[model samples]
Target: MKGIVMEVYEDKVIVLAKDGSFLEVNRDNRDLDIGQEIEVDDNNKKIRGRIIKRLASIAAAFILLITTGYGVYGYYTPYGYINVDINPSVEIAYNLYNRVIDLKGLNEDGNILISKIKNYRNRTIENVINEVIDTAVEQAYVRPEQENVILITITEKKDKVDDEKIYKLVDSHIKQKIENTEVILIEGDNNIYKRAREDKISPGKLMLIEKAIDLNKDIKFEEVAKKPVKEIMRMIKEAKREKEKKEERKKLEKKTEKEMDKIEEMKFNKSRKAKGKKEDKLEREEIEKFRKDKTKKDEEEKEIEVDKIEKYKEKDQRRYLKKKSQDEFEEQRKEKQENLIINDNKKNQDNKYKVDKSEKKNKSKRGHENEYKHNKKERGKDED
Candidate 1:
């Protein structure tokens, strides 16, 4: 039965099943959390099961231990060199406390391998090496169930570590963690290391290349060395597929960028056309306004000219009327003078006639008087 651990106690664990039933399993607390998954061991009547964690951790600690107490006798427990050659080479040295004391890279490929397993230092060398192999297998550095050659050499004193102890610790661990790989152990003279230095390749890589050459006599080490480990492992087929995929992805991205640029250009052209239209409209309105103002000014000027002409006509008419009145007045005055002159002449004639009549009367009287005086003179002379 599989269940989630609800609680952990000193001697038991309470697990919650999927059916909402609580089960108390009588087992030692293995640092299990409340939500840890566990399987019930069917063989044991005591409801005991393994607590499964992540796949990586499970692969790292695949070995089942016989003894329970995790103990080290001293602080300076030294486990000598463990040289691993998978085409990459690595040599790891551990102290009694399971911490890494020194590491050596046999070649360029081995350099980064040390960094991969460096964190496992100061821990148990068994589980640490298990983690290294498991991680390497997952990363495709080592192909399990394939023809990869591995050579392991451990050198230590009898008191510190023995052959059987080292063999039991590493041999089964590698076998259980990795599969189908030829493992070679060297106690005295390591010609593999000498061969690696001469070839300028790691011992692990040299082993693999020689193994491949053994299968095909026509293949040369120089030709195989030109290819990387992953390419060599895939035999050149997968590498071609990966390259093609990368090229396809790049082409798709370039096409997408081109489409986006075209869209932006179209938008910019649209905006430019809009702005041009707006400017043209404003220019047209300005032209209309200017024409209207010009027409208005012309009309006003025409009105002003018409008013001036009307005023001039009125002034001319007034002047003409004044001149005619003056001429009429002068003609009346001349007529009046002529009439007065005629009247004066007639009065003078009458006066002359009256004076003449008076004179005539006087003369007639004088004549009569003269006649009477002649008669009186005749009478007086007769009387004398």
Candidate 2:
């Protein structure tokens, strides 16, 4: 006889059927309760026919399970989703059924419905389950296999962002520019993005963009940049150099003007000296002409004196160091003229022919000496 029966264990029933069976089951969570009667079939009542064999059935089921888990890549057409096991890293379970359905290529209405559910992320496992139920309510019921339901769902929760830590870091960056930088950059939990639990765009990236828009949107970066002490000193030195260059340029201009003035003054003095020399030459020529024009001559005596006078006139004027000034020279000349006053001891007219060559015509005997000739003539007549 062949037999089929159910025995309860752990609030669930397990079915066993036996007919010449092997009960060497390796792995199954079906432990039979002791002293429970199982349906049996016997032909001779000596255990030779058939009996309930739960172990054999469990062994067969286990062989099928491992084979399915390692199944090769293929199109999976699922009439309904039963139990599903998720990777531990996938924290959001609301996306589980939709991902599987999309991979399977479901209908249009089904796709949209799944998408809405996946968009709703729940922080906890219970919330995720509720969300999945809600998704089912939204979709019109098309009855599915009773055994096809979620079994195992693993999740990785995102780490909560510590606002305090973020605030400190932001303040640190801001404090570099402003004396009192305590403005908040991140507002709440949305700023915290967990990579393992979710693949989301980094929220902190928008911090710079947000800062671009503000009440006073004057973002100055130079103030934040730190200047090295050496660099600052270098700038100061450069500024000083520029100032010195300006001052030096002014000084050079002044110096050039002074040099120009000196040149002009020297030219003026040279011109004046040239004019003085020309005037002095003209005056000396006029004095010599005046004295020559006033000259007189004696008829025969004058002829003899003319050769001597011509010789004296052609000779260079004697350059004698003045024994004294013009006043002294004039006084001396007057005394000498008075002594030559046709003295009663007049020796020159006494022996004119015997006069020595040096005394021959020591003074003028022509026009300039006519005044002397009149004295001599008067004295000679008196002697006659």
Candidate 3:
């Protein structure tokens, strides 16, 4: 019969016939592949019951593999951790669903305490922690009459988890369950837990040791690790008070310095103002002195001008006097010459009058002599 190979096995091959029925045939040494057409003998055909049985076996194996993978993933993966320290240090590890997946003891006392508690399977983390504390109390690891300190450090591996809420819830629950016990809750991270594991101590104990060292630099990590939590808290308080006092002193000194600087600035401004006033006074004095000198010089120049004018007037007066004297002398000389000319004219007139009178008397004497001659001549003619 001709058929198409569907599955190949070591001893047999499953094939689909053209008639739409499945057949199981014994495999030969020849290479046969799935989906390849081939010829098989009708005698080699097996019953369909064997194919059903083989398919059922494969289905059962696949289901088992899936279930086992899920189981390992859920049980082995850690989501968060809680470190409980009370002298008996126990670290509990939980899965994503908040179920306790693992529990470990960090010390000998922790190991002993963990051995006493049984059946951690399927228990919630809160129940596991409460049981651990109750077991510790029963074992005399935590005493009620004395001072008991319980430190819980929580570290989360996922961001979606609310670490603060978990811390508050755990703190509130443990405080209610135990009486007269001091409970300290710390929210921690992966790095603190890793370092705690390396140091072979619980995370809560490691945190207290670190804080003690910060408060007192002289205290070594080994020394703090051996000390109790109460002593470390006391050292931190004292150191903080000292630091606050030093800061106050520094602030006071700064305030005093600022006041002194302000006073010096005011003094400098006052001195500068006084110097400016003195300079103004000197400038005014110099200006006044210059004005007085100018006025005195102008008066001296006026006096010199007045003296020059007086000298000019005196010279003109002398010249006028000399001209008047010369005019008077010329008038007197002209009057004297006119009087001399009048006297000479009067003398000449008088001489001329005396000569005329003499002439007239002579003429009369001549007339009488002539008349006597005529009379004598007539008397001589009469005698002849």
Q: How many residue pairs clash in each candidate?
A: 7, 7, 0
RMSD of model 2 against the true structure: 35.3
Clashing residue pairs, backbone N/CA/C < 3 A, model 1: 77-95, 77-96, 87-204, 87-205, 98-122, 98-123, 99-122
lDDT of each: 0.62, 0.38, 0.74
Which of the two candidates, 1 or 2, achieves a greater TM-score against the reference? 1
Q: Which stretches of candidate 3 lie over 4 Å from their true place?
A: 1-67, 177-179, 245-384
Write candidate 2's Cα lDDT for 229-254 as tens digits.
22322344455676688789999999
Q: What order do candidates take by lDDT, descending?
A: 3, 1, 2
- After superposing all C-alphas onto the true structure, candidate 1 shows an RMSD in angstroms of 29.8
Q: RMSD, each candidate, Å?
A: 29.8, 35.3, 30.1
Write the residue-wise lDDT of candidate 3 on 1-384 in tens digits.
776566779988876666655678877664455544567666756546666676445444533542586755755578888888887789998876676778889888889999987656445676677788888888987775777777788888766446567566666765675677777877788888889888888777888888766766787876666555555555666776766777888897898899889989999878767778687788789899999999999999999999899999889889988888888888888888888888788778777877887888888889899999999999999999
Give, for candidate 2, the lowest lDDT window spanning 10 residues: 81-90
Q: What's the TM-score of every candidate structure?
A: 0.31, 0.15, 0.45
Which candidate model has the greater lDDT, 1 or 3?
A: 3
